[model samples]
Target: MRPQENYMVIISPGLLVQLMERTGDGRSVSVRELADAAGCHPSKIDALRNGRREKSTIDEALAIAKRLGVDLLVLWEHTGRTVPVPAEPPHIAAVPA
Candidate 1:
């Protein structure tokens, strides 16, 4: 199996927490601040940060990457290395099963 195929990769919760901690703007920012900037809800950010959520959409991930000032692909690569998400997109049918 290809490396991407064999490994299931995802961004770690700690990474998000670390990013939030590193913001260092003096004034405390709520999860909403980060999530809104990242185009998602505060709860979503909290979920991801606390490990209550497992996965996020590509758009959501991209938004977070943008807010973090990192390339989306690079973040994905890092997440893939650390979390090992599925290399290939899952197959889904238009028609309901």
Candidate 2:
């Protein structure tokens, strides 16, 4: 296999807490302030921060990244993707018998 083909950057969820903590250079931004800036609800931010929620939408993630003055991709851990997501997500075809 070609080396280039083997290179894949997979970004997972759950980096919100770190990003929030790092937003102010270790000072950390308030949930309300972050929520206002990132265009997401404070409760959602709290959820992510406290691990009440497992993941966040890409828009929210990008917003947090933008507010933090960092690249969104940096927030995610690089795990090699063994399976690629489809361009068009597959819809459930049936409930099964």
Candidate 3:
């Protein structure tokens, strides 16, 4: 018998929406602008916000995070429940494995 592979799911649309809302004030940015910044289509961003898209590329997420001025890991933590940054700045470190 073959064993089923265990997959680790990371990030969620709700969390993404939360981060976006937090940074964008629900209108701080438009879908078109987010798409342009993320190098993706507006529909993709819409889908992500609406919970239709579950998987996201690291580059895409990073770009969005950069645009939002939020830490990539902070957003990841919002979805994955994993803290990738420390409480302090300048000496920020990844959560120990």
Candidate 4:
């Protein structure tokens, strides 16, 4: 059976920062708050906001977008890059004695 491949999800640092800016009602959103809402680590959000990180898992991206009240495509996008899944080793037939 062929293994499922994975693709890269690019997160726009600028867009993420912008979205985070407007997250709180009249107030700025904190990294910890956003992280909690997104079910991720605060450092993850900080990295994405500061352009230190550009990639995220689809689930993470979706959670972040949902928490920010925006569509997933608004801040995250799928890239052409794909990680191929490793195939299993072939089975060898033993010679009968």
Q: After superposition, how far is residue 14 of candidate 1 from its true place, in Å?
A: 0.6
Model 4 TM: 0.66
Tens digit of lDDT per residue, candidate 3, span 1-97?
Answer: 6563222223666766666665744446677887899898998789777755544567787778777677776654332335232222333234756
Model 1, 1-97: lDDT tens per residue?
4343232123577876776665434344568877897687787789778876645667677777667655665444434445545333234213445
Q: Any idea what lDDT model 4 has?
A: 0.68
Q: Residue 66 error for model 4, in Å? A: 0.6
Order of the predicted models by lDDT, top scorer first: 4, 3, 1, 2
- Of candidate 4, the 10-residue stretch with the lowest lDDT total is 85-94
C-alpha lDDT of all candidate models, in order: 0.60, 0.57, 0.62, 0.68
Query: Candidate 4: deviation at residue 2, Å?
Result: 12
Q: Model 3: which ten-residue window has the lowest total lDDT? A: 83-92
User: Which candidate do you rate higher for lDDT, 2 or 4?
Assistant: 4
Candidate 2's residue-wise lDDT over 19-51, tens digit each?
666664666777898888879789877865665
Query: Against the correct fold, how does model 1 do in TM-score?
Result: 0.57
lDDT of candidate model 2 versus the reference? 0.57
Clashing pairs in 4: none
Residue 65 lDDT in candidate 2: 69
**RMSD of candidates 1 onward, in order:** 7.0, 8.9, 12.9, 10.2
On TM-score, the leading prediction is 4
CA shift of 32, model 2, Å:
0.6
Candidate 2 residues lying further than 4 Å off, grouped into runs, are: 1-15, 24-27, 77-97
lDDT of 2 at 31: 86
